[model samples]
Target: MSGAAVDAASGAPRRGEPRPKAAATNQQLRQQAVDRMIEAAIALIAVKGAAGLTLVDVGRAAGYSHTLPNYYFKSKNELLRQAYGRSVGAFRRRSGAWRRQALRAPVRDDALFSTMLAYVHGGCADPAGARAVNLIAAEAVTSLPGLLPEVRLQNERMLALLQDRIEAGACGTGAAEAPASIEALLVLAALRGLVSQHLLGVPAADVDAAVRMLHGFIEGGPAGGRSAA
Candidate 1:
């Protein structure tokens, strides 16, 4: 009830604020706090990169006491790790169903095209998560050695999946100009580059054009029916 006391250490309520309603149980409240912190961390990583993110920043960004993040996550590394997982989860939730279906079947060239299109669009659907993933990925190489293995595994899995799709669909159609392995790496690299450029303030129209160009190249054109150079 509103009259119930919220523990001071919980930091769930500020001075004079009504206690959480009875319908919001303590477990639910705790989960809400953790989710908020994770989202705040993602936003911070999107803006400032994960290299310098602190638990205090996460707590404050989430509108909680600066110590609350530490109470929940303990360390910046752990917080960033969880934030990364949450970002990945959000992307999967956005586009996982069709992707799973596509990967399981013998996709045609058009299906592969649709799958690639979905990958690009899905990455942009959650701008915060996309930017956070890119920023965190950059940090993994230079500033966050502890995150290297995890980041590497994430990329390797993606590359492998793309290659499988390319082999199963595009290569079979003779539309692919390069080896499936090479095509997969190129597609993965292009996607990453597009995301990085967009995060660096590239105009959306230009980014869209580049995506179209990527689709064109995959379909045997340099740009939507033009011959390749």
Candidate 2:
């Protein structure tokens, strides 16, 4: 229980100084702090929006001293970027897990639909992360080269999965030929709009219905009946 063997939950060490055997646990505690700070940022961003959230706010929310955030993260943007990465990483993990699970089930329309439904629902559940991601996406387009490679890669992976399912004819006929990249962009746009509307105090039922409609549209239903113009 040396300093190197600090407990992440309590942020306290078993002993006053480090021991060679306890180095790994100490590193684990540091990682846990970084992770906890990111999580706190997510919650605060959701409630106050990214523009309104501060390092001090994030630290307090995460049960750390006001200065602790600075020790872990150099600036607000750095913290945000890390939080954004964590959020996207979580989404990828979920999608990957769902895909792996689907491989074991009987292939059917329901399976594809269910997977897509869960994907959209997961995004909806964390509106703050969704919003932050959308913001980063918009910026990445013009910010700098390779500024958000991970985000872009995650997006591509999501689109590829949808494309594969559609091509397999599980979703329907048009899906096979539809541009997966375009479809993914459209779906992300719709999700951002829906989340934004909700954040602006739009009714929950309306937001939920809109998301469902979007899911239907993506699955080759009559959801996208309107013209882009």
Candidate 3:
């Protein structure tokens, strides 16, 4: 207790240093900075569009120095990619239970359909995240060519998820098999359109009605109506 505070059982401190929590503190602060920047980026993209995003703008929006985002992220494109990835990750987490339920009964088209519905509703549940996705995707098509690959990749992943479920059900004995790829494409395309409309300020009632009608179409045969010669 004379020179420096004793370590109790270990005697006195060697350098009289209290302790170093800088590593952990720095790590936590760094993570907090990253999270803020990413959230700012998402908010910006939701409003300004990905094509208009800049590292400086993101840093400022996060309430940090204009140079801070660049310090953490290599380039504007890199930041945009991370922001997009974060939004997608959030969407997946929100729908994780639905995905699990579908996986549990992979052979049931009804289960897959329900899961798809959950995904659509999940977007509604998180409008900001969904709007960020929609804006990023739209910009990827019209402007942000660099992000087009990512957009395309997400679409392919969605298609594959649907196809896998449909294929699994098709493989079942005495199952009413349809063309997996085509069926999956149709379902994904319709759902994506509906979700886009929802993000574009479409009335929730109308979107819900559309979703139900789409579900009915899916529940019906590939034809969905009329005589199938």
Candidate 4:
């Protein structure tokens, strides 16, 4: 089985040299170790919940001694904060780039749904980042006292961006639901659910079906509805 952390190039590890996943890379990956630590921390938090995580556990999970994380991060809270920030920052970057593409293309079904599909698919592709985001968000919903205020501010901005883009694309198209903010929140909620299933050890086939269902609904295809009962 492939490692949970994606390979830098092929997105899955190669069969060559061992992965120097700690903060010991050369000039190119000076932050590779740090990145791995964040990924391990994210995955652990997803499986163990926020309060169950510890610096020692995070370090051991990242394939290093328990003190490795301590050298880089002062505490578990700091590590979680940094991991959450990095995840959101990446999403913002991807969404911004997609929005630029949307600016060039017409806001028709072809453009809008394609962009949204890619956006959703990207998260599914990067499982570590997706798990981190959902776990951090879940943590915030229950106990946000330790999370940084900037994280909340970043989320607000992201939601605003989603809503604004939806409004722009749906202008006169009559496709978007009322209150674009609510629609945006719904989409975001679906993404959270997607990540939740993955972290909870759901079957890959089922997870793929969920992603497909979301894409279908976004593209005006059948939602693949099933009885909840």
Candidate 5:
């Protein structure tokens, strides 16, 4: 007790040394476990569709006992819901970045295409996103028609953003002749088609060329093709 607090066990802290903090609280630990479970769930859905995904599989994937996922979420549906929500939130954040960029830039269409390219290329670079997208599509077709209302709404907003940009860019150009919103929707449809093709094992190079072609069309028109500024 004289020099520094020393006992039969370890000694006391030294000068300028960072003190060891207390262990993580139960709430923190639980949250970490939940986060792991969610990540595992997303990864699993990406690899395999969510047809028969179970808490057991998720927990195992997360390197935890199956009971852990069960303790956090009661059912597979609940887990899927959480996973989808996370994916949507991620998409919103990415789109929002582009929206801000477009608002700040002189030409909005450029920013809008940049945004779409960001989303489209994200799927190419990140397989998990692609898998999740396919899973969502499969869910939409096989299980329910209007099952993903929130996803639909978010996508609609994205379309609106793209349309507004396209409309803005069309000023004083032949491409401006066509209705902006309609053209935006058509462009959106084209992108979706490309996504389908990519998911169906189409060559990425081909898909990328197709995207570039769409970009060309956006910049140019039926009369001629020109790279956008």
Candidate 6:
């Protein structure tokens, strides 16, 4: 008897017995395929840079037929956007975890500084992901206005943490003044610039030195402590 007949008689899904609720299974399969494609794309971008990424390449790397990526993503830009969104979400989660951990610690200034340093270092070490995040940030400034709300929320949370540390005298700044949001912005910008330079072939020692200098500045050292206007 045919597989379908056997399935009917045995009350089991035999071979390809129309798969009851197959739509759900198919949807799951599609999502899995898309995830694999995104992962492969990220790996490729890490190794080859975004300029070298192609949908066909992603499809082949993902173990899918050449047309599969096209089936899921209409264009390379869409894929890039999706990949970037995923990467940003992951970075935010990592930063959030560090923030939570820092908040739970003994409220030492060093602990807060160390947490920020670790978070930046983690991001810098992943060059492709870093680049992807920057690209998204640039795009958000123009093309994606909706992302601003989340970005602002994250910025506010980070600023609040820094301000709290500054106020608590944890920063050892001796300045008897709270740091302005601009100070936090400068610190973030400096770290990001240093990481971008490192990704462009700058030496680790140079990056380390720059990070130290910036940290010292934020902590009220001569280089970084001038009050924001």
Q: Of the candidates numbered 3 and 6, which has the greater lDDT value? A: 3
Error of 3 at 119 (Å): 1.4
Model 2: lDDT to the true structure: 0.66
lDDT of 2 by residue, 106-178 (tens): 7543544555545655565567776666665655566533436766786776667665654454454335546
Runs of candidate 3 exceeding 4 Å displacement: 1-23, 98-109, 170-178, 203-206, 222-229
* Per-model TM-score on C-alpha atoms: 0.73, 0.60, 0.76, 0.60, 0.76, 0.61
Write candidate 5's Cα lDDT for 1-229 as tens digits: 6445553236556767777798999999998998889888888888877775788999999999978888888876677777877776675566566556656767534655666665565555556765775586569657734446645765688689788877766744446667777878888888767766777788877776676667667766743333532
Please, what are the lDDT tens digits per residue for candidate 6 over residues 1-229? 9867887898877764475653557789999999999988877766665555789999999999989999899887677667766776677677667667766777544644665565576676677777766655655577655455655665576677665654554455533343455566666767678777878888877676666666666666664534310
Regions of model 6 farther than 4 Å from truth: 1-24, 96-112, 134-179, 197-212, 223-229
The local lDDT score (0 to 100) that residue 226 gets in candidate 5 is 39
Pitting candidate 1 against candidate 6, the one with the higher TM-score is 1
lDDT for model 4 comes to: 0.66
Local distance difference test, per candidate? 0.76, 0.66, 0.75, 0.66, 0.70, 0.68
Positional deviation of 162 in candidate 2, in angstroms?
Answer: 2.3
TM-score of 2: 0.60
Model 1: ten consecutive residues of lowest lDDT:
220-229
Q: How many backbone clashes are present in model 5?
A: 0
User: Model 4, 206: alpha-carbon shift in Å?
Assistant: 9.2
Worst 10 residues of 6 by lDDT: 169-178
TM-score of model number 3: 0.76
